[model samples]
Target: MERKNLVIVGGGSTYTLGIIMSLIEEKENFPLQNLTFYDTDADRQEKIAKATEILLSEHYPELESFSYTTDKAAAFADIDAAFVQIRTGGLAMRELDEQIPLQHGVVGQETCGAGGMAYGLRSIKDMIDLVNDIRYYSRDAWILNYTNPAAIVGLALKREFPDDLRILNICDMPIAIMKSYADLLEKDVWELVPEYFGLNHFGWFSKLLDKAGNDLTDEIKDKIINGDFLPTDKEIANDESWIQTFRQARQMLIDFPEFLPNTYLQYYLYPDDLAKKESPDNTRARQVINGREKRVHEHCDQIIQQGTAKDIDVEADIHGVYMIRAAASLLFNLKETFVVMVENQGVISNLPADALVEVPALLTNHGPKAFSVGEIPVFYKGLIENQHAYERLVVEAYYENSYNKLLQALTLNRTIVSAPKAKAILDDLIEANKDYWPALK
Candidate 1:
């Protein structure tokens, strides 16, 4: 039971409080010698840091030391792991990421199609710098990156940090879906084992098994197709857009019943429908800003005013739980199986060896060892190949600062197949993200 030091990059995020609460709850298993919050925004991090200080004192007072800072050297110093969830330009950029595409009559999701491309490009430079900073201070620290548009960011990190294997890119959508599946089957989430494949936010679950190893894929698919599928988490289900996302997942299954599609696939599979449903005036970013963002900050204020979180409803969210659990698996050598993003390297026999793919892998002390997916069918292979090309082009576009490469990537994207429309959206995105993205040639 060796205690470890941890640093949470982007500690100003709405997720920071929940993650800190999770650390307190799992203090026994994933004991921490120190905890640090590192963020660029001092005001934003201060609220969470002050509230966390009060909560930790009230709950886990035995913790040795805790602090928050903007100093990279102080934050990353002597840390065994880093939970990285940075937003390069924050939610304002995200609002544009969603809105600009819709103005072009295209899907405007945070992590799909043209919007994901925009977000991915913005994330690359920051992620690269963040990783370099972490290595400079804590060379051996495990960097658990759960950044949005993980598909592109994952590939960019792989290309930039080829020899550095300490980085692990992950997304919680699959876990969230599995929680819904478990709820439908009347079982706890951990009791089920799922076999899935493809890129992050663009994957499919080929099989799901109960603890007894009973095949539950078809059963869950049947339920999803027949009934109103929604997230099991009450907090998520409350969001209207999330509800639509789950409902659209049901529609995808009815149309392509071969494998269970990721909820995000709805954005790619039915861009026109999604675009029609999306209101340009009120995008997902707006909803989050008005909803969770407001609530969490207010709640943190209340906790700080009260000087105790004992009365405040402090529940560790799925994202926080997943991150802490995954980090623990790596630190303690738990060998737990979790779906994570890793280099293809023949994991998908038909896909290129260099492509970054998301698959279930065993989390050992060294990092994730991905499971072999063998060769996929022609239909899936075609879709994945196209998507992978789009992802690769985004990375290349960033590195080479080539506008044409980005246009090609957006055109190849399923959401906006027309070259003309892709160019229009790319131009607007370029204007919107000029401050963050590299100057394109």
Candidate 2:
């Protein structure tokens, strides 16, 4: 029952409210001594911080202190753990990430194909700087990074901070997927234990077991393959793009029933079909800006205007809850099993030892002890190798500013196999991301 101090790095984000609500909700289990919010944008952070102050006063006033600031040192100082959920260029850049690729008939996903590579390059330097700031302020502080394109970001962090075990790069997509599977099986998500393998947003569940150790993989697979696919989470279900993504996931499972496919695999496996359905003008970024972004900000404005959170529509979802619990596990030495991104080191016997792979690991005070995935079949191996190569080249391209390496990464990507298309996408992305990305030769 030891209380802890926490800081959420991206205080201005739409998702920050959810994390705050989740922290308040879990106060009984993971008590907080102090809570801090840090972001570069003072105006946006002020809005979120004001809403949070109202919510905390109305709900859990037990917190000893609550504050938000743009000062990195003030934010990082005395914090036991930091939840990093930053978007380097925000949604304006995400729109370009998705739109630019679709203009050339390739998948313009948030974390796959050319878009992911673009975002990944932009994210690398920022993440490295954030880590350095955290370490400088609190040498022992734990960093729970939930950044997008985690596959590339994770690899970059590993390379930069090889000996820093405190940084845990993670994504909530797998947990989101497991929630749907749990819903299908009529169980709580916590009761399910998944044995998974491969890269972030590019993995599969080999086995899923209930608390009693009953295998539920085949049952869930059957449900997905038989067109019983739908996200039980209301937030995701409300998004039409997410609904289509679920359907595509079902199609992937139907085509290859050996193991359950991650929903993102669809973007790579069926890029042509997905690309044809997309309107570059009305990309996923626009949907989010028009939908969740608009809704969250309006609710925050309402809470601020009313000076109370009693009737506000905002509430914590799985994304917030999962991150808080992961940090709690780290702080309290709970050793809970979670699927996190970590250096392979032979975890996946067939993949390169240095590759950053996502697998279930025991989250303890010392850091994650990754589970062994052993040798995968040739098909999955080939797919992961190609994706991993693309991820590696993106990281290399960022540091070296080698235009050719980026071209190679895009050409090898499953969503854009044509070298001509890859080159064109690269040039457009370079121009669009000139402000964020390093200049390439």
Candidate 1 regions exceeding 4 Å error are: none
Global lDDT of each model?
0.91, 0.91
TM-scores vs. true structure, each candidate: 0.98, 0.98
How much does candidate 2 score in TM-score?
Answer: 0.98
Which run of 10 residues does model 2 get worst, by summed lDDT? Answer: 226-235
Looking at model 1, the pairs that clash are none
Tens-digit lDDT track of model 2 for 113-223: 999999999899999999999999999999999998899999999989999999999889888899999999999999999999999999999999998999999889877
Which tens-of-lDDT digit does each residue in 1-441 have in candidate 1?
999999999999998888887787788879998899999999999998998999888877878899999999999989999999999889999999999999999999898999999999999999999999999998999999999899899999998999998899999889989889998988898888879999998899999998798999888987887787988774586888788788888889999999988888887888888899988899999999999899889989999898778677767767778888899999999999999999988999999999889999999998899889999999999999999999999999999999999999999999999999999999999999889899999
Identify the runs in model 2 with alpha carbons over 4 angstroms from their true place: none
Candidate 1: deviation at residue 411, Å? 0.4
